[model samples]
Target: MNDIVPLFGFTTTPLELVSFVLSVITVALNIRQTHWAWLFSILASGLYALVFAQSRLYGDAGLQLVFIAVSVWGWYQWLRGGTAHGELQISRLSGAGWAKSALMWLAGFGILSIFLKSYTDTDVPYMDGFLTAGSLLGQLLLSRKKLENWHVWILVDILYVSLYMYKHLMLTAILYALFVIMAAMGLRAWNNSAAVPAAVAGS
Candidate 1:
């Protein structure tokens, strides 16, 4: 871990720098609705797993592994999970879907937080669990090309920024802040894409 030294004259590790660059590229591609984002996600998540592990954020480290798997699944889903011909399309979650998502997030948060608090020496189990649960939901939604995935990310990223800051992960906190902005841009881009068909038909 200490093999790679200072970055940009900051005390940042190589793992953190690599993860940050990959994450930024991943989100940028995601905002453009490109399938290549998953590749970056896989790499970024792996590095982040190490970063979180070193920070003693066990939950988040495990979450990064899950993110890697989810990234692979998302890659296939985006390529072949759409209506007719394997083309993914932007869609909104229904009320029922929202309720289900909420239930899942809450349940995950509760269960994971308890486990973390009981089994780990981590000081921020609740916050870690919260972000992990939300990230899982956001990943699922993104895989399905749901428009509201960006909304999930927006909320999750804000909380993550705060948590990372509290943990003295300034670079990670900044990354999460960038995530918020990218998520908003993604929301707008998907919203416009979703409306294109309607506008054309109405015209």
Candidate 2:
């Protein structure tokens, strides 16, 4: 799977191509609020772990492992993490919730960056850590059916495009670019979905 092959006039490994496809499917299912998205996320993250490790992106490689574990928890959350332990509902973050998320992102970035820098030879430890932290926050928010998860994803995906390009992973870079657009769509869709409850309660 590591063998490089020409694709669309560029080059990528079969593993990357497969990862790219699975990730796209995962995001699409997520936008629809489908619980099955987590399964695809697990598969994609596992494959991408290998892809990132080969490039020596230690932070990202480790992150993919975390993603796999998180995806499992996320799957259960989507099914039962709501009022009265019923199906989860789409909801916005409170002001305090947003503050907590920001703090968590900063803390995770600081810790992961220091660890990666001290223990790994990856050339872009800081960037890797920053994005890895953001991705984790985004995934957590997503698992809880928080509306702001899409916002987190949009920022992370935009930055990831540049990072992947720097690492010469052109296909994965393109995937992140597509993720930016899809994240925006998800934000809008979830916003509308969230409003329905409010509108109904008001009515």
Candidate 3:
């Protein structure tokens, strides 16, 4: 097994490297309920957008554009969507939330897989669609301040790490490994917020 980082794809370039690094920090801080996550997301998604396009992962690439729009919206939600006391408190997804997100993921993957298999000559079409569709679900959940988003990310990131490894994108694989850690930390941090509520705990 090779251990060295592969210098292939968009992640190997300088801006992508910085963008990738910033993405990790942004995600980590976001889980900790910090507002800097959006900044890193804006940087990282811009680079990944190119990466996915080059790899013919059009669905994933397109998702990054949506991410850009959502990031701005998320930034605003994080800043002003809190209760009167302030601080973005984490919460679990409601039943409707689960139903809707699950339906969306299923529908997206089914449709995109058929489209890619028919119109595109890409390998691993199912995996591509699965990751892309699942990411949309995860990102939306995160934007809604749902703690379960971290759980979805944990599952998705695990799959991503393996997929990137197989594609020889070692750096991105490692980044996903870090995301797994960050997601765990996020779960704990959000649970803490739930116990005492970050906005009211100090006072």
- TM-scores vs. true structure, each candidate: 0.93, 0.96, 0.86
Between candidates 2 and 3, which one is better according to lDDT?
A: 2
**Candidate 1: where are CA atoms >4 Å away?**
1-10, 198-203
lDDT ranking from best to worst? 2, 1, 3
TM-score of 2: 0.96
Q: Candidate 1 clash total?
A: 0
C-alpha RMSD of each candidate structure in angstroms: 2.5, 2.0, 4.1
Candidate 2 lDDT score at position 42: 98
* Tens-digit per-residue lDDT, 68-128, candidate 2: 9999999999898877877888988999999999999999999999999999999998999
Report, for every candidate in turn, its global Cα lDDT versus the true structure: 0.90, 0.95, 0.79
Candidate 3: tens digits of C-alpha lDDT, residues 90-158:
788889988888899899899878877888877778988888889888887787688888888998999
TM-score of 1: 0.93
